[model samples]
Target: MLVVGAVVLAALMLPGVWHLLRHGLTIVHEAAHAGVAVLVGRRLSGIRVHSDTSGLTVSRGRARGPGMVATVAAGYPGPALLGAAAAWLLSRGYALGVLWLLLLVVVLVLLQIRNWYGLWAVLVSGVALVAVTLWAPAQVQTVVAAGLTWFFLLGAPRAVVEMQVQRRRVRRRGGRDESDAGLLAGLTHVPAIVWVGAFLAVCGVLLAAGGAWLLAAWPVTGITYPPWADVPTCDPMCPSAASATAPGLPFSVCDSEAVSTPPEIEPHSGRNESLSLRRALALLDVCARETDPTGLTAAEIGRRLGVHKSTVLRLAAPLLESELLRRDTTSGRFRLGPGALRLGHAYLSTLDVESVAAPSLDELARTTGCLTVLTVPDGLQSRIAGHRPAPGTAGRAVPRLPSVVPLHCTAPGKAILSVAGTALLERAVAGGLRPVTPRSITDPGELRAEVLRTRRRGFAVDDREFDPDVRAVAAPVLDHTGDVVAALAVVGPAARMSAAAVQEHARSVVLAARTVTRRLGGAGLGPSAAAGGAAEDLRARRGA
Candidate 1:
């Protein structure tokens, strides 16, 4: 009688228990976003929390561009990837395994909490669970069982659909390819539906198993059974001796907790300490090659390191302070900092800089039928880094010479200066904006305004501002962090390059800039820009 009563109680509380489990998954998801945001130097926005859902807070002020797009795309992939990881961890039974599993689930839930609709689903489910746990009557156990069964049937399918929709949206927005869309999507693409079908079938089995376990453990009556007597047996009727086996044993047993048990004496704790340190170093190596760290979070780092977020923070503290990594004040994004810059410079010094850019510049020249020049920012001015002569224009053509020029007076120079902000512009002015030509912009204030406008438009044009009859349009080449690091320009005769002609070629110039950017591993324009350009390119290519 007591065993039957216990089963009824367990059955009644199943829904609430499931909701509780989901809450932890939510936390892990949000933490992943917040961690990545912090790593990229984005501002920490407040977190939003409900019983079963949570969202990591972030805001980008001032700093807007490809970096922002990367950060937004980072959130969706965080959960599903982490969930798989946690599932693996649970299977292995690492230290504090159950807690880790819970954390992973929370992360999963938080990752799903994108809009109000998702938030509502989580909140309502959480409330239902809490209500059942605290105040549900004995007879209500039947209702709880039915509710949990229904939820497993309906909710899991809904989640799968929602995940697909979210992944498609991310791809449309130009995020990293669907490779990171998680296991489900990957399974969906298989020729045989077996993969997806197997996954769903497994989920169904787990749900059924869990439901049966609860139902047999908690009945409508209030009687109770000993914990040992509730353990599940694989063979129900093998023998009378086997009949001693418990019915709800799995409910009380946590796979993660059992697997993660520490050694009795904490053997070789000091030796193991070095393992985390080595792991940290390895992680830094991976991060070094990454052009943009805006989408990285502490939790994401944890996932990469096979450790916890707290551990990642502890390990990264020194790197952060030394400016090997920088935190973006506006968006709270992290990126390689001054130390990394110095290291990159030291490495680059060993190579011939122009050699790296020559082929790309030549390609630009051929495509645009205009002299192409690549320029690097020098103090107060820019030096031509590489140049290629226009196609089809022979020896009789006016010679285009490379010279150090005031940043405000030339297209490539202005394009680079536009991204450097006011302080750099002021320094350039202090050095003196010598009038290179009659059309030269000599006033520092006017030049500053123009640069601001150019930055807003993501490119710059010089209509014989550097030298009369020399008309050009240029776009800035950004580094991994989206800072303008170099410039690319197409220069030609002003008379031949009318204003309308220049405007028409702007798209070409920008496209070339994007190509160079991708080659250099930098993020390109936002989704809207890419989508619009893709449509235009499709039309152009089809016509051609």
Candidate 2:
């Protein structure tokens, strides 16, 4: 088995086969960067595993810091660390566990893929793992698992050596392009050769240790009396953290760390009950985190949950029956069904409108150089539920919010008046369209005409109506039922909001309102058809 494994590893490392096989290592390398980036408080944007066997992980955080250093440094050592882990698991008779664990890792990495080739490469790798773990016979699984353990243990150091040679060539050619080692060198203010040596040293140590474990696991022929055969193995449902941490195992029945960690339960409920609950929730959490509408296959779930498809069937049966999960007839994948929508609605229902619109208000205020407000209808009037002054505005000088403004004069008021339908318009007519300034519409027929114009575009523009020197643009924020919940508006001095600028601010105000709508699980007046008659309105404003 050892000789066969080495032969296959050597064959794969050849110039021809290595080109393709290297992609798996590249996936691990990039995934390592992403995993560490999350751990270090960076927001990961995406990862791309290229066809050239190169990879990139993009994350946002401080450009220079230990976190950045750690993220960059993780790539080269990742495969070796994973191999060491696999070898450790195998030595304990957890060959099946190793395969499942690798499958889980692959599935997690698959979620971060950013390109078509990255998607294709990861999907192929994940499929191969799925086939081997589920379809292969037991003996085939054991041998294949052992083979992979050896490959990762052997391949990692060789990759580092190759990187050094490639880096040297780049230096010789006077190229400024840097490898991970070069990046590390610059990060630490150390020489590039030192970082290269550090990478080599760590990989070599892990390789040696992993190799010893793999060698020891090989069965001896004609050795029925062998002392090692008598040793017992503990496949971990390691009930205590002490035993789990005693020697090599990294996980335990004792605990999990995320929202996936089992919740506290009654003492009488029993461990199996808690374990079962944790498994179900973890499954849902995985599906929910992925935004793809296509959902995940049963094979993908099995890989993700580290359970057999049979176990997925068992757990998912109740969820499907309850309508929390649904099986797609066309794709044979599982997706969160209508019942999950209740849970989402419940969550969104608890969110305060002011809290939801606050960020958008702040952002709009800065970006538009104006006051931004969230306005909601109260009786026949509009109230400012939230507002933020422009960046340079005096904090104490601006009026406090949650304040009232007329329903027919201001932009936000008109926006709400337009979407609140004809009933609200009639109510406004009964209450009277009191002019706030000379430019405010007071004529009932003209007020009706203005409402029609606001409905035509997705936004309403106030032309020195609320206050003679000020102008505003606003858009209605709608709930899922198409009810106007609020309006998002930007207010500025008339000089800054010229007819040309009103066109731009109109789109921005509409976009900001749509953003709040999305966050609240609400819908908006479809796309703003604000280009043609809108231009005529702008020209009319220019003439006025």
Give lDDT per model, in order: 0.53, 0.73
What residue runs in model 1 are displaced by over 4 Å at the alpha carbon?
1-353, 397-400, 481-483, 524-544
Judged by TM-score, which candidate is best? 2
Each prediction's RMSD to truth: 30.0, 27.2
TM-score, per-candidate, Cα-based = 0.35, 0.41
Best by lDDT: 2
Candidate 1 Cα deviation (angstroms), residue 248: 65
Candidate 1 lDDT over residue span 192-215, tens digit each = 233334434544555454444333
- On the 0 to 100 scale, the lDDT of residue 507 in model 2 is 52
Worst 10 residues of 1 by lDDT: 252-261
The ten-residue window of minimal lDDT in model 2 covers: 220-229
- Candidate 2 wrong stretches, greater than 4 Å: 220-544
